[model samples]
Target: MKERMEKRVLVLNLDHTPVGIVNVQKALVLTFLEKATSLVHFDYLEIRTVDRIFPYPAVIRLYEYKNIPYKGVMLNRNNLFKRDQHTCQYCGGDKRLTLDHVIPRSKGGKSSWKNLVTACHRCNTLKGDKTPEQAGMTLRTLPFRPTLSYFLAEYAERHAAEWLPFLEVKPVG
Candidate 1:
């Protein structure tokens, strides 16, 4: 029961755009209050009360479209690694991952999404304080800013396949 309650529910706007995620409790409350409707439910799960059983909502859509402003994804070490798919951008290695600046900060590089990438410890050390070109190293992929949908799509692939049909995620490749 505790684990089921801890499961996240996708929340979509009236227009079916993903707004955010909520815990099962919050999703149920929204549904019970008629503010939202469950669009998909976990097939083998159900919520039991004193005298009622409700389908476990996997996704819920609100009754009205929200004018939520699109705040871009935050630039952080974890997010950077995720954006780069946890593989070293220089060598495509998946282990000993570390964040690297495509252009060394000493050379006027800012720590923004476009300037950062995931790299292995070896690659970081090999590149040192020099740009990839200066070190004769090349990145496997160009670093770019990631959108909310990108992260959500990645999450959906891992934890919640039910949300996939509703999301408009472009392939990361």
Candidate 2:
């Protein structure tokens, strides 16, 4: 039962904007509490208890609009690599990935999106504690902060085909 229920559920704000994705359990809890309503249900799935069966929702919408604080995506290894498409920003190589400071921290570069790039181990060593200009290397792309919707779109892949209407996600080709 637990294994069957462990799926991603798309969550939307009151005005139908994508806010986040929650686990099925959280979606069920929200719907049961009347704080959210099921906007889309999974294809050909249901929750079966001892004596009752319930429709399993794939997308849920909040009854009230909650003002969430503005915070961009977290700074982490996985996300940094994702932003650069797992390729070295300096050499465009997709092997032995690592994070490199565009402007080395030793040179007062803050570790924000704009200042970081994915690097191969070779490039990382080559650019050690030096700006790309000083190291005679060039960055392939400028990184920017990813929005919540970007992560939300990635989460959409785990849901049922019936969820296409509610989430602003298109299938990745």
Candidate 3:
């Protein structure tokens, strides 16, 4: 049987950094209803309740008034893999992609995004039951939670192209 796709939400930094991803259904409601906003690379794009309205970037920055660290959330696999662009974390190879556990289950790894990574079978077996140091492997990028904006951007680009303008971002070229 085909597996069900897990849903995700978007995570936004107070500074509007697309720090990580969240479940989709939650993000949709947040964005569509103006309860939440989208975080682009540099700023938070506000969701307008009324037509033709735009959010002021200055207002969002003023509201935060503090520097905050990065945050993230769980997202779907397709989206996760896409965010990683199907590159294997172990060797940076892009073929025979598979999910890997940074920390093995025997070592108390949970089946979660922060613990999981995209890898090739060779890397998976090589790194099995041992930490990266023990296995002589190093991650190209540290695994962390994804921002909601990343998920939304991915979702809209692939699933709802029409929403791009409403999102106030250029369509993926």
Candidate 4:
């Protein structure tokens, strides 16, 4: 099956400071219809705004906006494995890894971020067709969907380190 086009949220800031990213559809609508100005970077647009009037127009000012394209979903196997550095969840060893359904598929485990984990060949084979409880294995941490902010922070940390100074991310803990 063909994969669906991934939608992105645009990160915006006023007065060269951090704000939040809005859905691309919303951003575009605001830009085209609402006359929201776009923030231009070297070659890419860093952000766009819903409001256009500002103190300055040419330089990055209080009314200025930038767009940071939205990154993919965070805290899935991609995020977990990225966070875990691709080590086997069961052994913490560097080896070939596969996805383990925390709840076995036979038990109505749907393929989703909350239901999948990284496992080594041994763990996957040993767990075989059985639930973690049945296999006598325990998960180190429960899987969950990460909030948009969490993923945004992660994306900024990895790709746009300089953005940290501009963005204010509220601490989750």
Candidate 5:
């Protein structure tokens, strides 16, 4: 029951654009207060009260359009790891991951999304103090800033498939 309650519910705007994610408790409150409507349910889950059982809301949409600002995803260690799918961009290793600058900071590369990538300890050491090209190494994927939809789509794929249809970014092959 506790674990189930921890599941996140997708919140969408009146126009069906994804706005944010809320825990089940907050989602229930919004629905009960008529601020939002449930659009999808987790068929295998339910919320039980003293005498009633409600279908677990997997997605909800607000009754009114909330003018939410679109702040970009935060750049941090965790987000960087997520963007790289936890694999080394240089060698594709999944362990001992570290951040690597495609262009070393020694050469004035800023720690921005385009300049950073995930690399294993070995790869980082091998490419130390030099750019990938200078070290005769190549990145498997170019790093880029991830949009909210990109991160949301990724989470939806793993924890909430119901949110997938409402998310703008679709899964690729």
Candidate 6:
């Protein structure tokens, strides 16, 4: 039960902008060290050790503001699939997916967000080593870097809905 409660915790920067997710144990350690404070607890959940009882933290904020240097999300295969929601940018196919360069690398297109996209094996093979334009394919959407808030919000999704207000950056109806 204790281990289960220690599984996840949302961590926020001093500005109240979410930075990432951490385990509840890490959150507790931060709170103990005066490095962070709990913002809220999950309903009907508590952590009890031999010494005392404590509320199970759902969200926590750091005491000091760290620049975190704006090095955005990594440019990698898994991130590409996640950014595109596992759908082929071309033809919208959903199986045997692979990465495709919008402007083929052979033509000097760097492996960056703007140049990369998710594509099913069929589309990838059909348009091998050529620009999508040359292969007569159309991208469903242009790929770009997701905002930090949006990226962290995706991680918060596995937690409680109460986290929505804390992670909220963009307007929602």
- Pick the TM-score winner: 5
| Model 2: residues with Cα > 4 Å off, grouped in runs | 50-52, 106-108, 128-138, 158-173
Question: Which lDDT tens digits does candidate 5 get at residues 1-173?
Answer: 99999999999999988889999999999999999999999989999999999999999999999999988789999999998999999988999999998988889999998999999999999999998888999989888888877899999999999888988673222
Task: Estimate every model's Cα lDDT from 0 to 1.
Answer: 0.89, 0.80, 0.58, 0.57, 0.92, 0.83
Candidate 5 lDDT (Cα, 0 to 1) = 0.92
State the lDDT of candidate 6 residue by residue for 86-108, as single tens digits.
99999898899999989988899
Cα-lDDT of candidate 4: 0.57
**Tens digit of lDDT per residue, candidate 4, span 57-172?**
11122244556564535545577675444777667766878888888889899887778878888988999998878888877666655445555666667654434544545523
The whole-model C-alpha lDDT of candidate 2 against the native structure comes to 0.80
What is the overall TM-score of model 3 with all chains considered together? 0.49
Question: Judged by lDDT relative to the true structure, which candidate is superior, 2 or 6?
Answer: 6
Q: Rank the candidate models, highest TM-score first.
A: 5, 1, 6, 2, 4, 3
Taking all chains together, the TM-score of candidate 4 against the true structure is 0.49
Supply every candidate's count of residue pairs whose N, Cα or C atoms clash at under 3 angstroms.
Answer: 0, 0, 12, 5, 0, 0
Superposed by TM-score, candidate 1 places the C-alpha of residue 135 at a distance from the truth, in angstroms, of 2.9
Pitting candidate 1 against candidate 4, the one with the higher TM-score is 1
Instruction: Specify the highest-lDDT model's number.
Output: 5
User: Which candidate would rank higher by lDDT, 1 or 6?
Assistant: 1
- List model 3 lDDT by residue over 66-104, tens digit each: 355535445566655776769988898888877887888
Instruction: Provide TM-scores for the models.
Output: 0.86, 0.75, 0.49, 0.49, 0.87, 0.81
The parts of candidate 5 lying over 4 Å away from their true place are 168-173
Q: Rank the candidates by lDDT, best first.
A: 5, 1, 6, 2, 3, 4
